[model samples]
Target: MNRAFNRKRDKTWMHTPEALAKHYIPYNAKFLGNTEVEAPKGTEVVEDAVRKLKFQRHIKKSEGQKVPKVELQISIYGVKILDPKTKDVHHNCQLHRISFCADDKTDKRIFTFICKDSESNKHLCYVFDSEKCAEEITLTIGQAFDLAYKKFLESGGKDVETRKQIGTLQRRIQELETENSELKKQLQDFEEQLMMVHGSPAGSISIQTQSTDVFDMVPFSPVTPLVPTQANNASPPPPPTTLPPDISKDLFGAEPFDPFTCASADFPPDIQSKLDEMQEGFKMGLTLEGTIFSLDPLDERC
Candidate 1:
């Protein structure tokens, strides 16, 4: 368990000084811009976007060379010019052209840095007074500028990606709105068809609708009958009779009937007796005063 705990990785390893150099280079610079002016100087530049070039001229207490000035500002995109005494900034953001060469022109050892002026358009030169380390100072400044410019370009790429996401969302919203309209149209068509059915001849019952009816639907509803439409046009039924021949075919406008068998069509004696007794009660001024009786047609109900 102890070994496993000891093997935990360092999450902050990337923030270490050595690891940080991959994204940024931190270098202290010296100023030797004027070869004729002799002064003891301590110089360093530090910042997030643009590094300030600070110069503290070393001289006797009575000398004018003992001045603290911050005049040049450097970043990845371009350089800025400033007032040395007042420290006021000047010029556009893209203000300077920077390149380097050896002071000896070919020595490659005694390095010199050069930058073009924004207003003058002429080049200014500088070199660290230290004989052995001037080359290191010149090379470090060049690399720092490169990294800053790369970051600026990456920021622009993020803006383009955000615009693309916005455009995609707008198109999706339009599609949803169009689909909602089509659904509303389909619902309207279904309501109209329902209204037509209620007003047809099949639905014979009259329904009174109110002005405040919800969704324009019918106010009253009636149940439909199970009988077919042909029943309405049929003739009235015939009176009950005790004849052998079937007379129903004429009453209902049907074809004349033929006998089912070559014999007399008659009820059983017991059935006929019950039917006659029921009929005699009608003569006694009663609609019916008899026992139960039933009669079925040969093929269908009467």
Candidate 2:
């Protein structure tokens, strides 16, 4: 019956629900101290509050039980970890004074941090089981101090003046950008005008594209026929043509009027006949070539 009762009691486990609960918020190490005492040196790394190599001392004491308590606290910057090394509660630690010591390779898993104590101003050393964790924590602390110092100024605050100068430069750059945009627009308008004036006559305006290849185009202009010009050293103009005997006034009638006003018996009748025939033919040719006939009046089909 006792064995059955013991089995039943063991089956009914306590704090099962508590063990399964999830802790989203981070917690600190349970304790940090020498491992000689039968107590926890620090909280488990899984419960670390900061995502860095950190530890916190936790003393587990029950009600009506007396146990010496260990005190631990972090300063404002959160880098200074306050853990007293001596009995007088002195020699606190700051992250800035800490460095990863390059000791001889004794153990690959273990590393040390040499830090200066705040109270005694003497260097204190601490060893860790994880070399990677030590290096990471040391690098983080060094970067933190660097960032803090870079942010610090004469006024014990942020460097606002440098920020203001940067803002001014940014505004100047924006103004320059606006000006550049305006310039580009003007250039585009000029290109369009050029296309209208010069490109249309040559051919369709082949606008240049954003490419490294080059295309050459000829400009166009209207051409006028050349006029003949007389050179300066040309010969003088020919004399005006002599006036022929006035025929329109009919000074000489159909009867020949000789300047001698006398008829010559020596003139041959055949020559006179030939001259009359030639005159008649010349007059007929003039009439045929110079005169226009109205063909419509003579057209019987009309």
> Which one is best on lDDT?
1
Model 2: residues >4 Å from true position, as ranges? 1-92, 99-106, 153-302
Which one is best on TM-score? 1
Per-residue lDDT over 164-226 for candidate 1, one digit per residue giving the tens place of the 0 to 100 score: 444455467556555655655666675555545543454342343334345553344366332
lDDT (0-100) at residue 84 of candidate 1? 53
lDDT per residue as tens, model 2, 144-180:
3323222332222222333334445656755655665
Residue 223, model 1, lDDT: 67
Q: Candidate 1: how many backbone clashes?
A: 1
Please give the RMSD to the true structure for each candidate, in Å: 43.0, 51.3
Model 1, which residues run further than 4 Å from truth? 1-30, 34-96, 101-109, 155-302
Sequence-dependent TM-score of model 1: 0.25
